[model samples]
Target: MPRIVDRDLEALRETALRMGSLAEAIVAKSLRALATADPLLCKEVQEDDLEIDRLDVAIDAAVLELLATKAPVATDLRFVLATKSVATDLERVGDLARNIAKSAARLAAAPRIELPGKLDQLAGECTRLLRRALDCYADGDPERARRVLDQDDLIDASESRVIRDAIAEIAAHPELSSQEIDLILIAKNLERVADHATNIAEDVILIAEARNLKHREKLERAGDRRT
Candidate 1:
């Protein structure tokens, strides 16, 4: 039974990795569509998101089954729980990618609007953070997961700058209000993508160290406020 459980857990990891890969590709394609304003690419991203959603459901069922039947304990239980958490984060990443693609499609019909370089930077940061988070999961490296947390602040700062620039653009040229709004939405989506990546990294930490780092972070924030 132990051997069978180990085999099943390996299979679960493989399935979860496949789901992660698909989610990453969707995010990459969504960014490309945003840069090019291609409606067809946007449609493709939406189609891929459906597959991601299906995988999320399948992974959740597998995790639950393993828990009920295998009765995983210690490290094995951590692996199961982490797989579930990562799947959820990946699914939400897919949703955010779809939202960005939809915004791209909406802007495709309008006059070409120049996207800020910072917007591109933010997108690149988001993709990099996500890839690193997945690497942490693959290697069970909490240090790498900690590094992923650091990258989130960079993306967040970029989002703020882009948002400010977008608002300014809208104020200067009211006729380009739609384009500016799309830029704002794109920045917001990219920020959300980074957030989900951070969640995956946190899950990796939880799996590796058996520490509730998120709760610790909340406590630290509370302490900061009191101080």
Candidate 2:
């Protein structure tokens, strides 16, 4: 029975990894659509999101079944719980990617405005962060997950720069406000992708170290008060 349970857990991990890969691909393709203003690419991203939604539901059901039948404990329990959390984050990443794709589709019909370089940089960083987070989850490496956490600030900073530049462009050319607003929405969606990646990394750390990094800052402040 123990051997069978272990095998089932491994299967769940593989399924979660596959879902993560699909989510990453969707985000990358959405960014490409945004860059080229390709309505076809945006359509592809929207179609891919349906698969992500299916996978999310499948993972949740698997987790529940595993818990009901096997009653996993200790490390196995952590892995099962983390898989659910990671799946949820990946689902949200897919939704954000779809939102970006929608914005890209709008931009496709509008007059092309010169997008800020910072937006490109932010897109690249968010993609890299998400990939790294998935890698850490696959490897069960808390250290690599921590590195993903460290790079999230870079995404936030780049997003801020993109927003500031887009706002300035809108102010200077009010006639272009619609297109500029679409660009701003794309940047916001990309930033949210980075946030979901951060959440996945935090879950990876929980699975590996049994330490919840999600509330580390708040917990640390509380501890300081006690001291």
Encode model 1's per-residue lDDT on 91-146: one tens digit a residue.
99999999999889988988888889989988898898888888888888999899
Model 2: pairs clashing at backbone N, Cα or C within 3 Å: none
The total number of steric clashes, by the backbone 3 Å criterion, in model 2 comes to 0
Each prediction's Cα lDDT score?
0.88, 0.89
Predicted candidate 2 versus true structure: per-residue lDDT over 42-61, tens digit per residue: 99998999999999999999
Residue 171 CA displacement from its true place in model 2, Å:
1.2
Candidate 1 residue pairs that clash: none
Q: Which one is best on lDDT?
A: 2
Give the worst 10-residue stretch by lDDT in candidate 1: 218-227
For every model shown, what is its TM-score relative to the native structure? 0.94, 0.94
User: Could you tell me the C-alpha RMSD of candidate 1 in Å?
Assistant: 2.5
The lDDT of model 2 is 0.89
Task: Name the lDDT value of residue 111 in candidate 2.
Answer: 83
